[model samples]
Target: MASGKYLSILALTGLITTASFAQKSDADYGWVLDSSKRSVKNMPQQNEFLNNQYPYPSKPRSMWELGVSGGGSFIFSDIDPKFGFGGGLSLRKSLGHIFSVRGSYNGSINKGADYRLRNTYDGINGPWNGNYLIYGNKYVANYRTKVHQLSVDFIASLNTPSIYRGNPKTNIYLLAGYSILGADVDVDAVGSNGQPYNYTGINFEGKRSDIKSALKDKWDGEYESNGSIRNESRDAIGRSDKNWLIRHGLDLGAGIAFRVTDRVNIGIEQKFTMPFDDNLDAVKIGSANDFISATQFRLNFNIGNSSKNVLPLWWLNPNNYVYNEVNTPKHMKIPTPVLPDADGDGVTDQFDMEPNTPAGAAVDSHGTSRDTDGDGVPDYKDKEPLTARDCFPVDADGVGKCPEPPCCTELREKMMAKPACAITSLPSVQFKTGSLSLSATAKAVLNSVAQQMNANPECKVKLTGYYKGSDKRSMQLGWDRVNTVIKYLVEQQGIGEGRLIFSLSDGGDPNTVDLMGTTEEGPNSIPAPFPNLQKSK
Candidate 1:
């Protein structure tokens, strides 16, 4: 019983040792970095290196894990033969993309109470020799009794992809290691005889009582033939002497690991150990004590999913990145041209000004648009390209191309006669300095003018255009200034072109300053002082 208890303690110790090694190995390599070989100095730096040429995360890191399991054992010995059952625990650590190491401890206690023993002695058959003495008696002895044994083991296993527990979903592994074995046994008799005997005694009081009792009970008076002194002396050998022994042995196991999640794995393993020393059984016939072997089936759980990425030893070698069929190194250099059409736009760098146009779109000479005004944008994109006649042909000036003196003079007289008909009173159709866009204040006034135009369809007006310019661009600038106002009246206000008129001049006419001409900013500069349309009139 004492020896069996010690074996259980040793098994528990082995389990702790296994967990210790796993934790140590995990701590040693968990945050390990190989900065000595990683560098940015030799590779393309800053603007010289293209963005895609740089490396990013190759793979996400895997975590570490632990597991445990249990099962039974079959004990064989001459003193007792029985089946005992037990359980154990294990720990494992993953080393990057290649390798992993594991340790585990397991043991069992068998109380082999219902056991049997068989003994058969080959009769010493030979021609009677001078030295050989022949006796005419037959002897047979067997012991049926209770025994206890404990087995403990420590194991280390290697995992591989090509082997077991290597593939992603599930893997298998082979394990081998050493263990300590211990046991305790109580016996009934010694030698090939039915009588109980003891090997030695202290000669103290009450020591020979077991032998005296055995002789009086099961011996049936045959004990006197073997002699009372032999019984008394041999009875000392099997009685009350403490004998506990320990031995180390080899252990082997096989298991399958399955990933339950990204960070955890569950495994089932079966293992057995063969003790090198025979003290494990302690009660065998003759001089040999039979060793012990335990078989256990366990459910193992790994914490960090180490088995998911069991790495190969030579993974860091650049040559390992080779392709077999192509017979070429995957990382070997091959010239790759820098593509010009990065955005996949049809436009090339040289000819296409807007080379990076959207992938599927029509472009102009400058890769912009065919229609600068974009009244309908263009025929390619305009759903209502021909919806409005004003979109097709635009009259630069609101006045008709042919202006007869009688008709023009008549219209001008009527415009000046109205009290609210002055150019300023038509709401401020202001223009930007050196631009045709109307300002916020100008837009407000223009909106009012549009409202008035919508109310009075019969009203007619002439927009006399002028520019504060003293250069070759004076006429062009003045024309654009007048054109802007005319477009607003006709296009925006829905005023008929025939109802509006425009006065175009190369520059502000000095002699006709008292006429209906208006002053504005210079073509290439800002206006000095605002021109008063009243004074000009």
Candidate 2:
């Protein structure tokens, strides 16, 4: 009936906790969510290393588990085993998500008896035990063992959550370790008369339960006689002539725990203890070693200040923070995607090779007017698309135009002019507003310009830029653009300094620097009219 009340209290506690957690939202943690402000580092950047760019958060410091336990400890040896009471105290700590270690001290009193009476000289019973004393050779086996042990155990958690679950309420684990033990094995042999009880009247051939009942009536419950142990290394307690057998052993076990709150939990565990020596029941009658099995119920508490530390690692899910972040991010800084379609075309500026595509004009996915023929002209402007080739250059209306035949006088004039350059029309290089840096597309266009300039040494190139106002900043922007183009041709393209012209004029297209080749003489590098207006380099 008391168990029922305890179970009801546990259920009510969990229900209240779950309801309280369900009330929380992202806004509830607003007061405590800024990891940057709570950083342990001196500088902001050092703390920002794990902020929004990375998924990890600083690990919280936690404390060890302190436990108190009690249950039954049973022993198996030469005698028939019966349940005994046991209890212990332990401390545990986690090294990581999966492993932990525990230190424990425990003790128990276990008792057992044999129903079939036997002679001390029988081979199966070995030689007579000194615990019989004056009781002589005939005896019924009855014994009680006292044990105390200290052990260090390595524990492994079997249920570390790797998916998106809240902290687990139940933790299951397995453990294995070595133990140092001291046991006092004794026999309840002599009766109150100071002589072994007479066995002649007791039937050794009756049913097991009936024989056990008869043996009980003839015996005393006192376990005052000590069983013999190896004398060389054993220690006698107080003034008693009997000594405890020192033994080394192994403990193998598993357990499960249920969390009642952030600070407390309860667990059930069982351990099978195997001792190296066989003196646990007083007699070394058989070759098999003795064993003890302990089943325990543990109540554990976490020891630490609530404001400074978290619960033990085994109770916290490793994936909890990350899963919540992806679903409802609180600390992320993601920029909105900006897709500017300046010409009302169905494309963004970044991929639109043809800007300012006319409204109501049919265009391809690149925002360029489609052309059927392999000519350079768009279908919207081409009158004779198939006639558009190198020899048949198209006119403004896309009509084929024939070149005038070269006369003798024209040929003589060209020869006398010495070095006449034949260069094609070059494309304009566009820049982002207020940015002087050359983009990859701009650099590729200039590469073709350099190849053409290298082929025609006598050709002089003119670079022209435009600005809206006469203010120093506006004019300086235009000066920077024209000067930049001319420098690229002279310094980067290996063109002579005298072969390039820098021209800055009133508005045409503020973002464009037009390139054209001619024979005009000009200065290649122009001084910045307003150096103070220069933007970032």
Best by lDDT: 2
Tens-digit lDDT track for model 1 on 1-537?
335743774575456435533321111121112222223442333212224354221232334355556555555444344446666666655443444555655556542321221222223221111112222222222222222333333333333222211134444455666666443333333333633332233232343444334432442322111100111223111113443334466667655554444444555555556654332332234655444444444454434334333232211221122222135423334588553544333333554455555543444323432332345453235433222343354333221223336758876555435333222233235454556565544543444445444434444555655655654344455555566666665677676666555665545541221112122312322242233321210
Task: Provide the lowest-lDDT 10-residue window in model 1.
Answer: 223-232
Displacement of the residue 379 alpha carbon in candidate 1, Å: 27
Q: What is the TM-score of each candidate against the true structure?
A: 0.33, 0.56
Collision count for each candidate, in order: 22, 0
Which candidate gets the maximum TM-score versus the true structure? 2
lDDT (0 to 1) per candidate: 0.39, 0.69
lDDT of 2 at 340: 84
lDDT (0-100) at residue 26 of candidate 1? 14
User: Could you tell me the TM-score of candidate 2?
Assistant: 0.56
Residue 449 CA error for candidate 2 (Å)?
41
Candidate 2 Cα outliers beyond 4 Å, as residue runs: 1-58, 121-136, 230-239, 331-356, 359-537
What's the lDDT of the predicted structure labeled candidate 2? 0.69
